[model samples]
Target: MNTAQLKQEIIEYSKKIGIDKIGFTTADPFIEMKNRLIRQQELQYQSGFEEKDIEKRVNPALLLDEPRSIIAIALAYPSKMTNRTISKKGERRGIFCRASWGIDYHHILRDRLHLLEEFIKEKVPHAKCKSMVDTGELVDRAVAERAGIGWSGKNCSIITPEFGSYVYLGEMITTIPFEPDTPMEDRCGTCNKCVDACPTGALVQGGQLDSNRCIAFLTQTKGFLPDEFREKLGNRIYGCDSCQTACPVNKGMDFHFHEEMEPDPEIVKPLLRSLLQISNREFKEKFGPLSGSWRGKKPIQRNAIIALTHFKDETAVDELIQVMNSDSRPVIRGTAAWALGKIGGEAANLALEKAQQVEKDEEVLNEIDKGLSFFCKDEVGQ
Candidate 1:
């Protein structure tokens, strides 16, 4: 079979395997992507990965290590039943943004891509292919845009008419070249909803994101979250989706019927009271199957405490006190103290006093004192 026929067969097979969109492009866009990465690094927006590693991330040659074409696939992850709006009632909300509300897309997309790769190898006999679901060196979004799968929205996500920016991307690098798809035109004309909706100003400009200010990055980050970022985190115990939620194109997408993508009921909008009690073993058991669990429980638990603090729901005081005593992680204990302060009353004051007696870390002790002072002010006034 000629390369043209093989490409058609592959595209057909991709749709059959459940990928919503598929496109092919030469591994050349990495050149421009590399320059973009350099600019991002210079702006101090690149985090998690080292700036030196930007070359590897942007260089398609490094992705294949040999000449090849890229097969970019996008999976739509919209939800129909879920409301994107922040609840006015202040009920402990389950805030899984449209994209992350289900089974990990990385797993789903990678499995399907592997099937596509195997099919290609069977047809071509000598075809060499590498499949990646957000796990490789290639700029999957850039390749998707170049291949006409979708346009890059101002939110820095690929936007499709059917899925908006609520789609996950995967790529297959192959030695067998195919006719490339034409790139799409940008459609985000005069709309700044995503930028304006961002609570932390993570979107520096159209199609640009500062990871340092991004709540999604902050929630997944290792170590202590800075005080400023912590306060801005609000009730987001995991990834932030304010930008995608505000995108106009995401309207009317069906999220309820996507059973494969439905979040575990317990995880969909975890109760802050229950979250503060998660043991390390429980954390692993609950989140082991989740893509977000890669960072471990510390960050999630810390964020949970922060959320509890933000909610300032007095009912959670006893639970926060329990965490203060039982939780060993300094960050958790510290955050619990902070929560207690936010919920300050007689119960909170007593809990902070008890925590201060047992707390050994200076930071934790200071947090306890800070929490106590909230109620102490009332006592002085009385």
Candidate 2:
């Protein structure tokens, strides 16, 4: 079969295997993306999670010798969780962004790509292919954009017309020179909703992001969250979808095509207090399967403390005090101390004062001092 016939066969096979969208692009170097990446590095806007080597990130040739084509695939995830848990006065819950709703997408996308790789080999026995999900040297979004899977929305997501921006992207580089699909036109014309709605102004402008200020990146961090973004975090425990949720294109876009992609409402929107004292083993058992748990439990626990404080749930004072006084990680202890102050009451104040006497970490002690300062302000105001 000619390249056209092979491409057609691949497309048909993709649909059969539940690949929601598939497109192809020549594996030439991504010059534009390389330049943008350099600018992002210079501005200190890139999230540290990205592959450090800029050349390997943008040049498909570096990843696979004599690479002639890239096949991009996207799997749409559910926007709204069915059987959603409603947080009551005493049982407030923190949310994992829609991206983290189901099983870790990396596994799902990797499975799909594995199947595609097998299919490609069957068609062209001599075809050499290298597949990667989010963690690959090549940027998934850039490959998707080149393959015309979607337009690079101003929100920095590849927004497909069918799935909006809630799609998981993966790509495969192949020696076969399949016909490249046309890149989509920029459809976010004059719509600044995503940029304007960013809580931390992480969306510096269209198609550019300051990941340091991004709530999504911040929520995944293991250390003490910067004080400036604590209030901005709202009840988000892992990832932030504010920009995507604000996009008019993604409005009312909810697809539950894959059962594996369906979210367990309870896990995705777990009770804030219940998460505070969970053992590491318990956390891993409950959340390990989900994409949101990649950073382990500390960040989620810290965010839960902030969420409780955000609601000023005085009932959580006891739990926060326990975490502040006894948690092994300084970040957890420090954030709990900070949250206790935010949820200020006589009990909260007393806990902060007690923690200050024994806290060994200088950072934790500083946080304890910051927590006590809240009570001082309350007294002066009165």
Candidate 3:
């Protein structure tokens, strides 16, 4: 079986199966990535969600036996959501990043990888292939970059010239010795727009992201947002797109190729107040399909409360008071207290003062004090 001919056939099949871009690379250990990841670890820059075993992350041969080549695939998602919910004076909304706009890309990309695997097996009866999406041991972006699917963008995203960092990446390690594609040259040149535009300066130095400061990573933490970023949280309920939106290559780069990738305006940019009281079952049913919901509802709810404060949504003050009084999680309750303080009405201040008397958690107590301080700061100005 000629791998050159087989590679061409696989490329054809990929397009038919809705894969936007595909690339191939040798299954060598990612030495540069190892060094970079080690530096990130040393600096405590990792998001803590990554595989702790760095060896497993960098070596393809360890993950898959006799891995001759890696196949990287990218599917472009819509950058702009159509039928967006217009937030009025009283009805404000929080947004999920574009990556979580539709059904989880993991499911979508895995399905594509599965089909590709089946095709390769049919052609090479004894071919061994292992497929993986984001959760796998492999770093999907590194594989994609090496496979020529895209260059690693300044924002730490795999940025394809065709897809403009708006692509979901997946990869498969196969025993077939397919010829590798050349890596794309760094086209970003001197453009520091993405780094300059980061809200928390998460993109600390161009491509290097201090994940601790990344609003995207911060949005997914199931705890109180740091005092400094609480004001920077804005209306993002899940993930941050500040760097992506600021990219000059991503300018006017919205694509609605797949139906599953389309955003339901009501879901992605949902009403900030409505999220405050979402039940466990309701949260699952509504947002379960999106990739961003993997952290469950606590983080989203926590961010929603902060978002209310970002908008100073007086309408959410009553709900914030209720959460401060009754939410089961201390994080939610504490975040609600902080939101109330930022919203600062007589009712909000009174609710915080009342909750401080009964709240027991030390962290929650501190947040309650912070809420009361916001009121104190406001009075000083008045």
TM-score on alpha carbons, each prediction:
0.91, 0.99, 0.99
Model 3 C-alpha lDDT per residue in residues 1-382, reported as the tens digit of each score: 8999999999999999999999999999999999999999999999999999999898998988899999999999999877867987689999999999999999999999999999999999999999999999989989999999989999999998887999999999999999999999989999999999999988988889999999999999987789999889898999999999999999989899999999999999999888998999999999999999999999999998898888888887888898999998999999898888888999998999999889999999999999899989988999
For model 2, how does the per-residue alpha-carbon lDDT over 1-382 read when each residue is reduced to its tens digit?
A: 5999999999999999999999999999999999999999999999899999999999988989899999999999999978878998999999999999889999999999999999989988989999999989999999999999999999999999999999999999999999999999989999999999999999999999999999999999988899899999999999999999999999999999999989998899999999989988999999999988988888899899999988899999998898888888899999889888888999999989888998999999989998999999999999
lDDT of 1: 0.78
Segments of candidate 1 deviating more than 4 angstroms? 49-52, 80-94, 255-258, 376-382
Per-candidate Cα lDDT values, in order, are 0.78, 0.93, 0.93
Instruction: Give model 1 RMSD, 1 decimal.
Output: 2.8
Superposition TM-score, candidate 1 onto the true structure: 0.91
Better candidate by TM-score, 1 or 2 = 2
Q: By descending lDDT, how would the candidates be arranged?
A: 2, 3, 1
Every candidate's CA RMSD? 2.8, 0.9, 0.9
Per model, state how many residue pairs clash: 7, 0, 0
